[model samples]
Target: MDDQNNFGAQSTLSMPAESIPVESIPIESIPVESMPFESMFIKSIPIDLTSTPATNWDNQSQLILSFESMPIESIPVDLTCAPTTISDEGVKLQFDPKVIEKKYIEERDKRLRDDGIDQYVRLDQERQSDLYAGSPSPRDPIKKEVDFLIMGGGWGGLLIAVRLIQMGITNIKIVEKAGDFGGVWYWNRYPGAACDTESYIYMPLLEEMGYIPVEKYAKSPELRKHARAIGTKFGLYDKALFQTELLALDWDEESKRWAGTTNRNDNIRAKFVATASGPLHNAKVPRIPGLETFKGHSFHTNRWDYAYTGGDTLGNLDKISDKRIGIIGTGATSVQAIPHLAAGAKHLYVFQRTPSSVDVRNNQPTDPKWVDSLTPGWQKRRMENFNTIVTGGHADEDLVGDNWTDIIRKLSVLGGKNQSTASADNAAARQLADFQKMDEIRARIDNTVLDPATAEKLKPWYNQFCKRPCFHDTYLPAFNNPNVTLVDTDGQGVEKITEEGIVAGGKTYELDCIIYATGFEFVVNHTNKSSLTIRGREGLELSEKWKSGASTLHGLHSRGFPNLFIVSLMQSGLTPNLTHMLDEQAIHIAYIASYCVENGIEAVEATAEAENKWVQTVVELARLQQEFTKQCTPGYYNNEGKVSDVVLRNSWYGLGSPAFIELLRKWRKEGKLDGLAYETAH
Candidate 1:
């Protein structure tokens, strides 16, 4: 057992920072409740930390250290603390100098490691594999030109390809690294892999594809199958280059074409290149010392090794009945997978660094009646409704996120709304009050956890809106099981790993197997580091332009790279419902593609001024949502290690998705598409 000082250093606390200089909108005026669940990213903190008097650590393994539950209001605004003494049942707890000494040492070590300057796998550092560095041009002796070359065979890419086909752009090819379609869906086949977002709204083109999800959150197999179905539906299955990784892409000014080479040794040229390689494509492993040296059978959660587990995608892990297993990480992926691992492994030890705040996930099979009720245009309306309420925009009706609506109702009770039916006005006010309800939800978490120390640690100190809010009914209760143990590593992560198990808190854990659910890399690294070089107009490498940060009119087209589009969650749009955003992007790309071919235009790129205006818009929007910077948990949203409130601003368009789509539509209709310059085919 790790040494625990019932009393040592005082708890450090701080109020949510005031990053966005914008004035706050009152919640009392809005009629609808802003869903605290939707604002799950936002973090809140209380004032004043009263230091517990230092106590002697004797051989008291069973000693339960509990602090008095402070009220949400009573918590100090400035995070100040004073020491206190305690004498409980003949055990004299004395405030000692040793405790402070230990805390000082611990804090210093923590600062050195978690500073986000992870030297391991540093992209800037020198590497043996020049694969990351730039390589010589590997274009074919004779270019094989095509109408369109779509990168990534994921849902988004497939959709864009389908639309292009409809517009009579037949000569199109898709290059994918995976052996087949599905992109992320194909790769992540862990036992409990499923969509947390409601399947009805989350799954795209369901009615058109004539597909029905078995559960509200479709499982990995089903999701993968859906991807295949999309490819088949669009007739893109034949022209795709599977198991091929794009090596480099160089724009040939002489030919007015992009010469692209891939790992499969195929050199191809295309008039237009659409990069739909979605986020979460790359699997990130922790740089824990001795990770690779461990002589054991291991694989990432994304590449679920079913042969070792004795279960398929649907979770019947009867194979590992006698094996002792340990899984690292308590994030969303692990939350879903652990239950099955528990059932199979004789002794399952979960190595946790940071615990996730899991809300209720009332998952159920898709209702036939609900599906029947959803007609044409219902998806669009429902999607729009969800976007408006979640993003603090005025909506006709609050739909999709029921938890958000429930919180809004509570806010309305606290402060009355304009009407009982539906109120679209004062959405900003409604959202603010909804945050109040979230404060209550945080309290509810304290009430549930049996251990007070555990409860406090479990309680997320930052705003709930910072990280993706996870929903699971089974996750919390799973910890309550006698077979499972909650190893709370007070922010100081796992000490090290030994051949036996893991060395945490100076105690070694003996285990048969270890699992890592660490998650994906979020920071956008250029393809130049991956040996995929792209030279645009005047042979200026795209990498050189984006060295400081990304530059694009709408996170789609950069100024130099004409006829090239990116279809990911950049500043152009960010949404909980990824499919909706993908649909919007696909539509925009299709219009541009058709516009180019129909008008005999060879190339089109965003103008420098348009890119500048869009960047300004992203900065302005980020300045409005202070919650993203303030009160948010220390994660990718805010600079993970730094205490500052500045976050990496993203988005293509200045406004939200609905407004963005409308703008794109208007631009297409206007025929000018003012922000772009096109070169006609000679």
Candidate 2:
């Protein structure tokens, strides 16, 4: 991007010639699609004239000499040279980077913002489920008070609850909207749902449980079971409020405690409130036309219709074998589930807007011998090693030698400095390595798929990091089956949904079922991440206060929201593996909460000055990552190409979680938490 302050006198629409390097061309100077293409192309397609035979070239030279003696009309116009590798940078931005203008964003504020999210959903009721046999237990009829109250029962809730107990902050309770404890894993029970990352590192409390997974990537059921185990281990299940939904949350300054009202018409008060409604639980259905009018059975992948599908995650979907199925969206969820659907459905239609970058996933069962040969604290050590390498930091060994660590392993071999503290040159080297990796994955598609046209459409043109990379050994080969059809929409999504089928790319595919593979909506709108209005001391809603942007001293405690805590990835060192980040945040928040408890402190909040400085530092730190994410195809990671200034600034800790953890440990070591306001009894 050209420096906005350094624009020249030329019209803004003018673009430099193709000979100029793309990096040197400022984004504001021109849009990618409008720029004149290289003369190396013959008509609309590209070819290699240089590869012509030597005898043919001699004849062509003689013809050219003859043309010199003839009129200009006799000369031929050559439109192509030898085929050349196209650099990714040469690919123009699909549109001006600023596709969504400022005015439109302002107009869309209420619809897209955090505060307005609750308006779209049933704010007072929890998501309905028939899985649990029991109904909500009889309420206590009166408001109850506790030392700590945590919202959510999944990864964020359970993990933080464990940490709080570990720190001796007992007398806590957890309010969950779900019928059970596994947040995302509980809801997303699709046939192929499993952890993409290795189970050892992805699962928390592994050491505590002394449990080893049956496979490298644990299935969804195992993950949910683990969450239940952790909750029971920490005695959180007994203190949990199931089928409870928070309607409103507000601070009680007079009593110096926070009060919350639930959908069951019960009131709960706590000296401190911590929200950990992990962002991934809320499923999003695209507002395609006639979605509600579909006569056929349809369900979001998050809420899989197991009764109708006649299968669990193990995938003996015999019930749906005769049914023709159509699925919209081919992201991670779709990638994993498609193989199962293709096997069962009489005919399957995969409607893809943008093809996910699929790579090889050679998943294998865990070796019992490997588990038997273990050591103490081996899980943590393995996690650190994996974290170190993947975050552009070096590791001594690659324990989980899979696709996640593949690029970094190559980086370490080529240049030792490609780790987290990489120099600018090393960063560029990593990028080139990334491009090469994506190219290999693309090549794999060509070699694997029998049809050239299918292979070409499957080949992702953008950089690998733009979207979440998917890996599966069976996915590509499954497409070779006659029953599976790939409906590539070229970029424009499905035109719309009709009662009987989906209309995509000007074609309709009729089906007996339509499964939504669209994943969870990320926490882009600050107010609506969790559909509850949290009011602080000044009676300002969390969303309203964060209208400018979210600011937290440690991504734990926010200013003005005294005694309120939030557990999430924002303003914290955001690791690609979300569980690692949650663990780090749980530890950090627990430490602070414990500190307040041991000292007999009543309230804890960050000073405004500290918050401003932290937010500024966070914004600066996230600049590069923001650029990287923004370039990716529309996904939850980048707000589906509708990124706003606040979205980037509020979302993540830019550098890496390892650095953030170290910083936090050092801060605790100093024995004083500066820039935090502590309320003490005089």
Candidate 3:
């Protein structure tokens, strides 16, 4: 499943040309010193656009238009006409690029906190148990031994289990903290909760399970049901331990096994262990002063209080009709839930820090005819097509045509093949595309929102991918409602929470309930996020080993962690469609596990040299990615704008998801398992 903590809502809004003014500037008249850094390269270059096509710019022409020898701050032109593609209507400067860059930096600065990731408090077992009282049917703990023990029941764990089952390895057990198998889907049951990515690609094993999503983007209920279906179809229910929090995992050198302990007082021993604990497993609330003193009813979006809200996922929140509600954080979660809150609350106050780039999410029902026309391996092909396009590669056709692919295609126009790198020309091109998309988004806010002041506050000034992009038809319109108010904090966020309500900008707004849409603790240490104590060979803690940064070969096997597979984004391929990446990791893990079992290999681990080489390669490739992240607004994506060495070390494989997958595929095809060392069983 995609990060439930990061999913946003969507709806369609017509593009308004009047929202953003476009002006044609003469090249000779404009001062070279006044140009923004991105426009420096084309300073004196003459452009004859009379022969250019009206709609799409020719590929050859794009290649010739390079921003190679320009300073980043000198470019002043807006070259893009739309969010998706460039037009041949001649170059027009919609806004001053240098001024916009300054505005972005100013907006980002106010949001930066000294505490960084520590500004939010991580939820623990006590909090989760209290929130989910009477969950998992309250089962007694037990001691058991198995061939494989998986640490999560999300898509990552489920996919691994399914692949292992297909490989004829059945002695497996999955431990999930939630009541069911859906992981994020199980927890985030708020009104309007749904996957942001298209369900066909985001939901894994759809073809294998012979299931078709009811909607192009499936809702939380359906996603959860699909998770259960996978468990039932593969007989995973019998092997799953629900509502169990794994406490610690220790490598048993003498027995060649992994000893595990859980919060429920259960002991488990397994020959192999795969930690599929998801990145967004823990929910967090901002560390606002006087938060504990608030007498008003409150809850995080991840742990939605349906009893108080009186609504299911469909958003009939009738219970709050007479109550004054306040929601903090205008992020992806707030974008999805605000409309529902506005509909039910007598008065709604949306407190904003940094605004999310709200775009058009024209969701539709899945076509039965399209589903029927699919031949064998159609899903794989469709998935690959989406991955290819999003990662700046050429595909025969755009299969999953959506906002994601469209924006990437626009960037690829100037970025060439490697989008991450900061080669002068590529960076300039990518920035131009990014600025264009964000302008369209801002224009969307201006058109959809009735109040000009509110629209201005709602406009996001950062790059498109700085934070997860939000799509919603009604989110902007919701602000137009007389009963709803937008309280933008000028990026300083809420000042404090009082007994009556929230205090922002030195003003107190009394609220009956406050909903925290602050999101999860991403970009932290894996052990801290998952709440797992993992000790490998010679008692080397995973946290200590990765204190500086991650040390793994292909993000799966670390040097000291024998028979321990880690399923996460760290040092692995990162993509918007997380399940696709998870499936790739699962397939690779299953192959190695099956091979080891069959070959009588007692233990396997990445060699020290191999791990070092992989880490070095990741660092070298990450230079471009780091530069891009540095320019983004403060958020989980850029480690709250700190970008420390640890963040750089823990960065995803810099070569993009498609390249990372191919690397693994080639490694497997060789049948050598080149980087791994194995100890054969006696």
Tell me each candidate's TM-score. Answer: 0.77, 0.80, 0.88
lDDT: the better of candidates 2 and 3? 3
lDDT for residue 488 in candidate 1, whole number 0-100: 59
Candidate 3 lDDT tens digits, 1-682: 1345342111011111122111112222222111111222221121223332322222322212334447644443344433343344322446655677778878878778888877888754454552443655766788999999999999999999999999989999899888779888888888888888889988889888999999888889999999999999999999999878899999999999999999998999999999998888788888899988989898888888888999888899999989999999888788889999999999999999899887788889999999889988988898887877666555779999988777666645533343323245444544565666678889888888888999999999886767787767788999999999999999888999999999999999999999888888888888887768999999999999998988899988999989999887788877778888899999999999999998999999998888887777666545334545666678887788888888877877654666677778878787887889999999
- How well is each residue in 1-682 modelled by candidate 2, as lDDT tens digits? 0000000000001111222221112222212111111100001111112332323222221111121232322212111323223333222111221122232233223223232222123212233353543576676644789888999988888888888888888889899987889887776778888887888888888888878888888888888899898887888888888878887889998888999998888689998888888766466666666777878998777667878888788787888878999998888888888889998889999887667778777778989899988899998888776766565454557887877677545533322231222123332333333444555777788899898888877776555555566777777887898898888877666678888889997778888999987655564555576658899988978888777778888787788889888876667665546777677778877888888878888888998887876777666544434544444455555565555677666766543555566667767766677778888855
State the C-alpha lDDT per candidate. 0.58, 0.64, 0.76
| Residue range 1-682, candidate 1, lDDT tens digits | 0000000000011111121111222222211111222222212111111221112111211111111222222211111222221122111112222242243235333433455524223222221112211343344333467878888887778878877887788899888877678867777777777877666667778877877788766777777788888888777888887766787788887677888888767888998898877766555556676665555566677666777888876689987878777787777788788878876777777777666656667878777887787768877788766665544445556667555333333444332233122212222223323344444445656766566665655554333444555666666656555566666566666677776777777887776677777666555544533446788888888777876666777778889898889665555665567777788788888888888888888889988887776666555444433443333444444434432322334422323445555556666677876788888988
Q: CA shift at 144, candidate 3, in angstroms?
A: 1.9
Candidate 3 differs from the real structure by a C-alpha RMSD in angstroms, to one decimal, of 9.0
Instruction: TM-score winner between 1 and 2, please give it.
Output: 2
Could you tell me the lDDT of residue 2 within candidate 2?
6
Angstrom error at residue 320, model 3: 0.5
Instruction: Give the better candidate number (2 or 3) by TM-score.
Output: 3
Clashes of each: 25, 6, 18
